[model samples]
Target: MTSHWPQPPTFRAPIQPRQAGARNGRFELALSRHGARTHIGRQYVSYPFHMTRPFAFDVAIPSLLTVYQQSSSGGLYRDDRLDSRIDVGAGAAGHITTQAATVVHDCHGQPAHQTTEIVLEEGAFLALTPDPLVLFPGAACSSVIQARLAPGTVLLLSDAFALHDPEGRGRPFERLEAKVDIRDAGGRLLVRDNLEIGGAHLSSAGSPIGDWKVVSNFMLVGAPDRLPTADELAVLGRPERQVVGITLLPNGAGWGVRCLAADAIAARVIAEKLFVLAVSAAFGQQPAPRRK
Candidate 1:
């Protein structure tokens, strides 16, 4: 006799590359759970370009399924066996980019937590530039990220978010907390960044975000020689209609850029310039055109 227990969900077919429509500049995948394990479903892409030879890597979605369900108390947990690790640059020269979007359907003021970990082997290059997270009104979320890079590895990571009120109501999100930690292969901490904001603070005139509806932080970690000169970085850090700043990472490892903008377009404009400048400075060539 076979005992009856709920079996984990399995992919019905082999994973395949998805072609994002011509209008959508970026590829996107919804988050879901397979049994007790959470998977981004099998979605991957490979591109050969002039940057550091040709390489390939998989993009994993890191959010939990509860986020999509209509529940009063949303829950979020990391599947250590799976969600905790992302591997990049397995063969030849490669680059991996991961994009994530957060959609809150009926959170009802429930709070959620998410954590992600990334590891890059020596000589591997990774760019984790997810689209801006859109937090609906009544959302209270916290996100944590940990990344470990080998000595010779290069990394470009970006995290950005925007608040939204779909019903045309003026209500703001409840709160948001974000933290990012970067370390070397030996577990030595290189940089730590944190952001916490509440609805009240967001309305304050002197708030750090000021009139900006979106905020973004971009960090590049690699050897000193891979970073741009101070003057070049300074010039790239300036953006009209937005507040932006750039600073070198500790111990000459790399640099970071922080920007605040009134809208998503403004933020992307600043990011595009910074990304191009960084790629040119580190790789000696412009990056392949990234879809909007």
Candidate 2:
């Protein structure tokens, strides 16, 4: 044995097999409308706005979502996954929904990543108000949203999150990385937001981007010429359990309303209120309620 070659590093297999949840996934939604248009501003500029038109798309399943995974028998496995993309074309309007909250299993050995892409054509409008994506105690994940808007399209975007312990007590952990990239028809970068939260970033002294509680962001685009005023924002009157901020984006001259809340419901409630106030002031028309 003394003269034998090295023992290939004791070749011991992993103490436990990787989790069976190691699966790839994708969900896609496309949009196109038949007929609809709304006038833009007092300058007499008019653009096609279809709030009720729906888009055309194909889904492998009957529902608006899809998933893949294998239950872990040993309870010590890692899952690798992705949430494909949602594409919207010019003159398309559609609503995409997930049957249940998207969950990222505990990353015993690897991290989970998801990406979302959205596109709008000239004179198009798209609203993303999907149900909140929930994360488990030990799970890890990241999501990204990229949108390309045509010359004069309007957009309403929002996101919400909530976390609790087994006893229903508010318990928050984990990290969140959110970024938004908006581009013009010529592919020019308009504005980008890079937001990160988790770990030591939860302290009150952390950068203004995040704190120890849940956070929500809502962006609304009106006619290229109309921008909401401070008086319009005052209509919100400060929501409970939230610190709200409002501003007009330098890019596309869009208006944005942001909030940090204690839970998902609170965040959504605050977001809806802002949506109503802004939509009315900007377009002089009330937006429809989001369908579950």
Candidate 3:
């Protein structure tokens, strides 16, 4: 395990007979520029993980690759230790999104753990915008997303989650522990965001999420020229049940966004809007629509 990843509690998983980094469930992807377009240079995928063939559908940015990640298992299970990694070689550009939202089912008495690692070499660009995690009642999860970026690289990463009780019992998830860590290629830490919330606390008196059902954070790390301008961001107006906060990142690396939505649909709009705006600013043209 890396120094930043906290150790997981011991438990038994009946689904996969392996730990993280083992051959059973871990998936890894590496991409690099091949001539004028980016291609998957290396890949290894195991059970529960699959991906579509790379597509260069964006006419405005024909060289950029797009992929949809998929999970075959219906949902997360108790004591699941899933690991995934992606590497963007120098000068490669790509966008990756999930086929749909992931459901974090009840973990029984053990917590499910997931770790994601992303590395971007110089001049590489990557955008990762996945649907939110739907936390079911009694769901306990620990999620860590770590990124290492070299100089001249650009990254747009978003994370979001929402609560759901399939039985309509009004029960919330047991616990959710999430962390996002970003570092430079030299191993210097850039930013770290940590959040731990219990499901019960979400329903107490005067809850912050009184009406909102989803919360998300979107981060952009890149040169100023590649960031979104104030004018292009005007589309993010004050909606009826939405709240957003935007701030510049350290050393002007880029900007960060925190948004709250009444539902998952609203959160998706915010993420998609920001991606389009930033892409236009960086590449000088709006990308062709990526239909959901």
Candidate 4:
């Protein structure tokens, strides 16, 4: 006698490009799974400044335009990889912003894992900041980011998120686990951050997030000693009606700032100030106004 059983369905990651009316930027990519490993198979990226074949790792040069990116599939899945490489100035004065709105869909009580890696080389001055990640109700996600930078690199890196319930129902998200690690050229760790939030903790009064609907973290990595001092950074981060704090990274590698606000705009304002200060300190000059 022989028994019959249904096999699991194979999953294919889809890439969607938004309309060009929004901005002159878009990315189309596909992901395939081989056993436990995920590979970035095909990709097509367009920017106003230049066009080139998408490689697993390469520098991203953007002109004086805002690069807008979105996922057509709406969300990520289990064991997905999102790797990117960006070079801001490249050798001349370059000013560009890439805004990524990463949305994770509900997984039917199962959690999905995604890995992201970014590299910013020397002589690059970039504001690699993404809009807050919006987690839908009942969605569970785990994300990790690794950034490698050179000594002369000036960067304003930000990570933030907010919860959402579009259906008007009060259901909370399942869980969000995230971590960020920054390393120097010699593979030495400069900063490490970890965050975890679940449904139960959301209802707890003692939750670390406490009533703050929007949380943003900004880190300035470059010439460590040239950055602002602890006392100066503290003064620069202070703002009304918001909780903000700044600290120095280990071994004088850089500085990190954490801000919590009642809304996204407020958080962005705080981040902007920090970005300006960091850029001025790193390059000894004010950066071109980030018009978006």
Q: Compare the candidates by lDDT and give the number of the best one.
A: 3
In model 4, which regions exceed 4 Å deviation?
1-66, 73-81, 87-101, 110-113, 236-240, 288-292
Ten contiguous residues minimizing lDDT sum, candidate 1: 62-71
Would you list the clashing residue pairs of candidate 1? 54-93, 55-93, 55-94
What's the lDDT of the predicted structure labeled candidate 4? 0.57
Which of 2 and 4 is ahead in lDDT? 4
lDDT of 1 by residue, 54-150 (tens): 2211122111111111112222211111123355432112233322344533334444455667776665455566567677776666667888888
TM-score to true structure, per model: 0.67, 0.66, 0.89, 0.68
> Which of candidates 3 and 4 is the stronger one according to TM-score?
3
Question: Over the stretch 1-292, how does candidate 3's per-residue lDDT look in tens digits?
Answer: 0112222343333464444432236879899997888899999887788887888878768658888878988777767778989999998988888889999988776777889999999888899888898999988888899999998888998888898888887887877788888899998888777777777777556556777888888888876777787556655735786788777777666777888897877888888888888677767888877867
Off by over 4 Å in 2: 1-19, 37-80, 95-104, 167-172, 200-213, 226-230, 237-239, 277-284
Higher-lDDT candidate among 1 and 3? 3
Q: By TM-score, highest first, what's the ranking?
A: 3, 4, 1, 2
- For each of the candidates, the C-alpha root-mean-square deviation to the true structure, in angstroms, is 14.7, 13.3, 4.7, 12.3
1 or 4: which has the higher TM-score? 4
Candidate 2 lDDT, 136-170, residue by residue in tens: 55544566777777765666677655443444543
